[model samples]
Target chain A: MMAARRGRSAGLIRLALYGIGLVPAVVSFVLGATNRLGADPVNTFERTLGLWALRFLILSLCITPLRDLTGVNLVRYRRAVGLLAFWYALFHLSAYVALDQGFDLHTLLADVTTRPFIILGMVAFTILSALAATSNGWAIRRLGRRWKALHRWVYAAAICAAIHFILSFKVIRVETLLYGLVVAALLAFRVYRAAPRRAKAPPV
Target chain B: AVDLAAQPGPLSGEGLKPTPLRDVTHYNNFYEFGLEKTDPAERSGDFHPRPWTVRVEGMVAKPRTYDIDALLGRKLEERIYRMRCVEAWSMVIPWIGFALRDLLAEVEPLGSAKYVAFESVVRPSEMPGQGGVLPVLDWPYVEGLRLDEAMHPLTILAVGLYGQTLPNQNGAPVRLVVPWKYGFKGIKSIVRIRLTDRQPRTSWNVRAPDEYGFYANVNPAVDHPRWSQASERPIGAGGGFFGASRQLTLPFNGYGEQVAGLYAGMDLRRDF
Candidate 1:
């Protein structure tokens, strides 16, 4: 009974966090669609959504640390946060395709190929899409240990996304540099934690 | 003196005021101060405008210096033009200024002079963005034009906009306004002018030669490395559907007739 109650509470908490995460993305989209943003509204909207997507992805990555540090055991929220991140990322990609490119597949393909930053972003989104698709319980049960291995691709996706952002700006700003540093730290933390545990266990 | 209120045709229309221009100009990407679009406006407000002087030298029969006050005393004209940014945004502005040709004639360029190079005022203390971590272009922004382009009637030595003295954020005292090229071609807060036989390196081109070429012409066919120049969104048009629906950017910002001849012989893709 106690275990079941704890599971229910965790599920509710996960739902609430996912709802909270959507606020900025939805507001930015509605505001962008309504023409409430400043000059160069489409770019502004696209950038806002893209940044939120990255932020949520980073936050979802940080959940393990937060759980370990606070002893709150918030792992249940990871999937929800990850999914929300993917949703925002989908919108961000769609905005560029629909508004900027006017659904011109040729131009979009040409841009993705010519621009290194755009290519990086596309690669990250592709990996993220794969992860999001196989996130269901049936897939997880079927794949078993492979599920964990596949999800590790998130780390690569995060790095690619960060590089995508860094190269986008003409001159790299402090805000962007700071975000890059945080992403680097999170990645470094995961590697540090994983390596030591594996060494101590004498090769799994 | 340039009477902005008396400009001909569409510019004289009631909505064609300098406020929007001022807003856009004041808020800009003067990379010497910093690369961010808004950095120049924020950091440049405290710039001291008094005691300014423009030194005209190099390849000139008579090298001379003119004080800001005396420079403003020359014949001024109001030109309403569409200022297009290479970043794919644009604004229509009524500029109050005298012809740059008139200013060049004052110095009297030598027969061999082929290009006109302009420099902006550089003061790091007042411009905080100058202390940024990134290695942007050197201080004192520099812009240049071919001799023919420099002498073009559309190129103006702008001292004011909207019938008012230039606000600090808008490159106060004096700046250059070339209607046909991208906004960066018009160097701001200019303090130096030099006539050279060789083509001069512009600020943007110096920083990223691959991205920003010396010509810097506004050609819709030639796109920026990361984005397309095919369209632009007007300022204060609000975001989302409202802006997406109304903003229809025109090639050469609808000034092709006035300035297209300058690039007739050259392939814009190579030059741009």
Candidate 2:
């Protein structure tokens, strides 16, 4: 009975987290479509989406740390949350292509080539794409042991995303520092949690 | 409320689309209020621009402070200038003001003066962003122009924009308007003008000397460390979103004909 109740609550939590995760991106799109995004609405829309994508990527990284450190497990919804990050990142790129750059291939190429931040963002997106493509149960079962190893690269994606944020701004603000610190702490926690396990195992 | 047709302009912005007041007032980079575009407009509503005073000092025969109203009493003309930001966006604004020389003439700058430094008014209460978590640059922003650039007829201390008294977001009662340089060179909410032989240390140049120079002439050939400057999105051109249209950025923001004589053989690529 307790297991059933736990399952029910987990389902609700999954639905709730997914619903919450979608709010900013949807609001940005709604604002853009309605022409209510103020002056430079295109930039507003694109930046808002990009920020949320970075935020979601950060939150997705936090989940494992939260479970390990605090015993508050949201593991059931982690996949969906991870997927939301990908969705936001996808929209962010789409906004840049369709709205900000206006399908100008030359400008887009210039941006990707000249800006190191853009290059880092592209790398992060590629990593997220790979993880997203193999997220389903079918891919999970088919790939077997390799799937977990592949998905673990999300950590690398988070680092790239954080670096992208740092490099993107002309002036790196305190918010960027704070975000960087959070990513660092999350990675540190992973290393801490792995240390004892590594101590017990044979040396690789 | 006045008609656009009656406004005296094209001394700078000829054949360029004027950025609407909505975009002008809303889309800003006034770090005093905030780095974000909307921060100044929303936050500056209560900012008291009236009862302001400007002090002209340093190497001048006579230094004095004049009330804002007294300065505005001079013959003011409307100049539609194309303002380009270092961030690679551009705007054509109808600025109303008299030549900076008129103001400088009143003070009688001494022969020792080779550069004129401009400083913005810094108040934590008035400028909401200063106390914020991450202010972009130092307070009471300072910018300098070479004496020749300062004495240029086109260099005006703008008092109004779009034929209306300047909004608080647009620098309120007083601001410097240098047409050829990037927008940051036009330090806003000005309170102090200093004439000196030594080159003045500007806020952005002090912050990142490698990135922002004292003479921030708009040069398309030179790219900012992070971005391209070859093309720009004029604010009103409907090019910002999904990039529909982008015009090539002009040398010295198309004021090269008027101001290139000032740079005269200086490599803007290195100087930039």
Candidate 3:
């Protein structure tokens, strides 16, 4: 009975966290729709959504370090964070397509093809969407060990996102550089933590 | 300070100055307010220019403070001048104002005065962008030019535009309008003018000295670190329509005839 109650409580806690995670994305969408954003509103909306999407992705990536340090048992929350990041990323891309480009698929395709930065951003979003699609428990059970391999693409997505930001600005502002550095440090921590465990294991 | 009052009347006539109409009316580089090319108009409108006084001091024979109204009392001349931004955009504005030479003469520069530095008014209440978390500049924007550049006949201290009083966003009441060189060289809503022997540090040059030099001459060949400076889009062009765009930007914004002698024998690439 106690175990069942704990499971129910965990489920409730996750639902709350999921709702909280959607706030930024919801607010950004409402602001974009209401035209509350200042002049060049479309660009403003696109940039704001894109930045928040990247921030959530970064936060999702930091969960492992956070859980390891705090021993908070936060692993159960990883799927929620990853899914929210993907949702925000979808909104970010949609803003770019529907608002900025007015759903001009030809222009959009041309932009992705012509601009290396846009291509990088598109590739990152595509990888994120694929990961988000396979995040459910059913897919996890079906894929078994292959699920972890597929999820590793999140690292590639983060790298691509950082590159997308650097190449997007005509003049490189220090803010973008700092974001790149933080993402690099997070990835480095993951690699460092994994290397020792692999080295200690008997030849596999 | 040299006495600007004794100088001859500000230059007049279309031939004596560039034709204001044929001149491009679109290029500008004032970024304190925002980043878009048209951002200055939207962001700068909120700037209130009342009860403003410019402090004129340093190496001049006399230091004086003049209110905006008194400064505008001087004869206003409309000279259509071509303005080229360092970011590769150009405009022709029919600027209304007296020459900077006239204003400098009022301050009375002494023999030691070799350069003139100007400062913009920086108040958070008036400039909303000043409240930004990041340091866009060291507040009270600054621009400087060699004494010769300051004295150039083409250098006008603008007071109005479009035959009307200057709009607040366009640096109303008083602003420096240097036809040659990049638009940033023309500091806006000036509140201070100091004549000094040493070269004064300019805002952009101080912020990123490697990118923006003290001279800041409009050289098509000298590219800004991030973008090419070889060409510019004229203002009012249809969202960068091809045929309507201006040809290659001229050196010193094509005011070489009036101001080129000032930099004679100097390496423009190094000085720029």
Candidate 4:
């Protein structure tokens, strides 16, 4: 009975996470519709979407550390959090394409190829897309052990996204410092977690 | 509302509609206040724009200090200029000011004066960004222009916008407006105008020489190392979902006919 109750609660929390995840986009839409996004609404809209994507990506990274450091197990919701990040990233890219670039193929190609920051952003987005595609039960069963190996690329995607955020701004503000520091800390924890186990037993 | 509705001034903005007054006052890049677009308008309430004085010295004949009232005595002409920021956004502003050449004539610049250096005010108590812990930029922002560029007919010492006294967030009291250059070249809240023999140190160029240059004329061909300069979105152009579509940026910001001769044989790519 306790196990069943706990599972139901976890499922409810997962549903809550999805509901909360969409608030930023809904708020952005309402603000845009009401003309409350200040003077440059389109730029504001584009940047807000990108900012939320970063936030969700960082939140998804926190799940593993949360489980390990504390006894709280929220593993079931990790996929939901991660897919939220992917969807937000998709919206961000769509804003850049439809609003910022006006679907100008020439400019889009040039930006993706020549701009270092844009290149990094695209790299991160590509990884997220692959992860999201294989997140289903059927794909996980088909890929078997390789699924774990493939999903590890999220670390690379997170690093690229952090660097991309840093490079996109003209000046380094406090928010940039905070985001960079958080990502650095999370990645450091991963390294520290792996180093002790590796020292105990070397891989053949 | 009444101020913006005044009669058209001596110069026109080529029939381009002025950006809404709300956007003009609220959205700004005044780092003295903060980095956010709305920070300037929100945080500059404590700033006092009155009781100002500008000192004109260094390589000038008279080297006189003019009170703000004296500077305001000159006949103000409204010239609608399309202000393009280096960040790839723009606004059509109806600026009210007299020719900068008129102000320079009063100072009587010496033959040796090849450049004009401008210095902004320093008031950390009032301007919170100046007191920021990180010090993103050096205090008391500075800018410069070639002597000929300063004396160009299009350049002006703007004291007002939309027929009213300049707002604190929009470089109150006095500021420089060079239509051809990117908006950073148009320094704000100027407290000092120094004439020099060599090129003067500008704030942005001093911070990042590779990204910003002394002569920052707007050219679509020259891309900022991080982003393209080929196009810009005019603020308040289209009021809907996507806002305004990006319009191609023009050489000399479409003032090439008036200012291109200023850079005759010089290569813009190198100077930029």
Candidate 5:
């Protein structure tokens, strides 16, 4: 009975995670539809989705650290958080293509290839798409150990996302700086955790 | 707010629709107040623009400071201009002011004077953005124009917009308006107007020389380093649905007929 109750609570927590994760996208849509977004509604909407994508990506990265540091295991919900990040990123790119670029494939292609920041963001998104595609139980079971290796690219995606965020603005805003710092901290923690393991590995 | 009285000028926006007054006043890039579009409207409450004085000096025959009220006494005209920002946004504003040449004429720029530099007011106490630990751009925002550009009839010192006193966020009391150039060239809250022999350094150019050049003319051909300048989103148009709000950015902001002669033999690609 205790095990069943624990499983039920975990399921509820996962459901809650998804519920909260989707709020920003819904709110942004409603705001855009209602003309409540500020003067530059399209830019505001696009930025809102991009910001949430980066936040979710960071949150997904924090799962392992939080479990190891505090003994609060949230491993079951990590996939949900990662999928949320992918969905937000997809929406962000769609908004840019539809609203900002006016479905101008020529300009979109030019932006993705030429603009350094846009290129970085697209690179991150590409990696996210691959990871997201293989995030199901069947793929995980089939790929086995390779799944862990492929999913590890999330760090690279997070770093690219952080740099892309920083480069989007002309000036270094405090909020951007804070987000960059968090990503940097998370990356540093990953390196710190990996150092001892690498040192302990037997020679091939 | 007291309304500003002015006669209609020769230049008119007859067919063009002026951006909604709400968007015009609410969205701004006055770094003195803050960086965000809404920051100026929200944070400019403490700013005081009255009882201001603009000091005219440097390479001019008659160097004298003019009081803001005295300057307002001059003949003001309502001129509708389409202002394009370097960030690919545009707005049509109905401004009330006299030609900048009229003010320059009063000071009598010397034969050696080839450029006109404008400096904005800076008060950290009233402007919170100026008091930040690390500033985004140099304080006392500065801008410059070639003597010919400054003397152009299209250039005016705007004191009001939409037939009313300019709001604090919109560069209250006084501001520069160069219709053919990017909006950043329109420096605000004039504290000093100096005539110089060589080209004066502009704030944005000083910050990012490669991206924002000295001659920030609105040319669609020359793209900003990061984004295309081919089109601009018209503020307060079509509710930004399906990218329907975008319009092709015209060369020299569609004022080329009147201002293109100023750049006669110069290569805009290099000057830009």
Candidate 6:
């Protein structure tokens, strides 16, 4: 009976995550309609979605800590959250290229090559794509332990994203600094937690 | 866009279309308020602009504090000009104000005055950005122009926008409007006008001298170290939808006829 209840709760949680993930697009549309996105609505929409994408990525990373520290595992929804993050990032890139750059491939190519922050963003998204593609049960079963090891790239993706965010803005704001600190702490926590267990296992 | 049909031919010939009023007023980069575009519009409610006084000092014969009303009482003309930002965005604004030359005339600048410096008002309590959130930039924004740039007919100390008094976020009471240069060259909420022999240290130049220079003229040849300046994303061109409308940037922002002669002998690529 307890197992059945756990399964039901996990399904409900997944539904809730999907609902939450889709809220930003609705909010952006309403904002656009009411002329509330401020001057440069495209920029506002793009920035808002990009921020939401980062938040979701951070939240997805937080789930593992929540499980290990408090035994409140939300592991089943991680893939869904990760995929949402990827979709948001894709849309953010679309906004930049279509709305900001006006589909100028030359300009977009120039930006990706020349702008260090843009290159970092592109790298983070590329890593996320790899993780998302291999997230299925079939891929996991086929790859065996390799799947678990490769998924660790998320941490690298998170760090790259944090650095990109910091470098993109003109000023290193307090909020941006706080975000970088949080990413650092999260990575440090993962390392500290893993070292003792890896030492005990000692190559099997 | 400014209604060209409504205005006389002489005014129409000189005028470029002003960006949509909402876009022109709402989208801002006044870092004194905050970095976000909407921050100034939202956070400037508490800023007190009335009874504002501007102290004219330095190499001037008559250094005095001119009230907002006193400045408004003088003969003013409407100037419609292009404003380009250092961030590669451009806007055409119809600003209402008198030429800076008129203000300089009042002060009677001394022979030694080679540059004119403008200082913005600073109230940390009101200006959220100045509250030490990002101390990267020096507070009380400062910008300077050569004596000739200061005296140019196109250079105006603006007081209003779109036929109305400027909103606080739009630099209420007074601000500098130099059509030929990047937007940062135009300091907002000006409180002091000083004449000096040496070039004043502008806010952005002090923060990142390599990226921002003293005379930040709009030149397509010289790009910002971080981004391309050859083209600009004109805001409000999308017509309530998202449009990029990247247009080729003009030398001196298409005001070469009036201001290009000032830099005739100087290399624009280096000056930029």
Instruction: Name the top lDDT candidate.
Output: 5
List ranges where model 3 is wrong by over 4 Å: A1-204, B1-31, B35-39, B239-246
- i-RMSD values for every candidate model: 3.1, 3.3, 9.4, 1.8, 1.8, 2.7
Off by over 4 Å in 4: A1-5, A197-204, B1-9
Model 6 residue runs over 4 Å out of place are A1-12, A29-36, A196-204, B1-15, B242-244, B265-267
- lDDT per residue, candidate 1, B165-220, as tens digits? 77676677899988778888888888999999999978889888888999888777
lDDT of 2 by residue, B97-165 (tens): 888998899899988899999899988987888788766788879999999999998899988887777
- Show pairs that collide, candidate 4: none
Best by TM-score: 5
lDDT of 5 by residue, B1-272 (tens): 56888999988656878888999999879888888999999999998988899999999999999998887788889999999999888999999999999999999999999999999998999888897765789988999999999999999999999998789999987999998999999999999999999899899999989999999999999988788898888887645454346789999999999989999999999999
lDDT of 3 by residue, B1-272 (tens): 01122223344324433323312222234556654545566577667777789899999988999987787677767777777777565666777778888888877899999999899887777676566655667877899989988988889888777666666666766889888888888888888999999999898898778678999999887777554566554544332112233357788888887788898899988988
Q: What is the lDDT of residue A151 in candidate 3?
A: 96
TM-score of chain B of each: 0.89, 0.94, 0.87, 0.96, 0.97, 0.93
Model 5 CAPRI quality: medium
Model 3 scores a TM of 0.62
Of 1 and 2, the candidate ahead on DockQ is 1
Tens-digit lDDT track for model 6 on A1-204?
Answer: 999998898899888888888899778967765656666676677777777778778888888889999999788888999988888888788877876778888777877898778888899889988988998889999999999899999998888888887876777878778888888988898989877554454564
**lDDT, model 3, position B264:** 88
lDDT of 4 by residue, A63-140 (tens): 999999997877899899999999999999998898887888887888899989999999999999999999999999
Off by over 4 Å in 1: A33-35, A65-72, A104-106, A193-204, B1-27, B32-35, B238-240, B244-251
Displacement of the residue B13 alpha carbon in candidate 5, Å: 3.1
List per-prediction Cα lDDT, in the order shown. Answer: 0.78, 0.84, 0.74, 0.88, 0.90, 0.82
Full candidate order by lDDT, most accurate first: 5, 4, 2, 6, 1, 3
Local lDDT at B77 for model 2: 85
Model 3's chain B TM-score?
Answer: 0.87
lDDT for model 4: 0.88
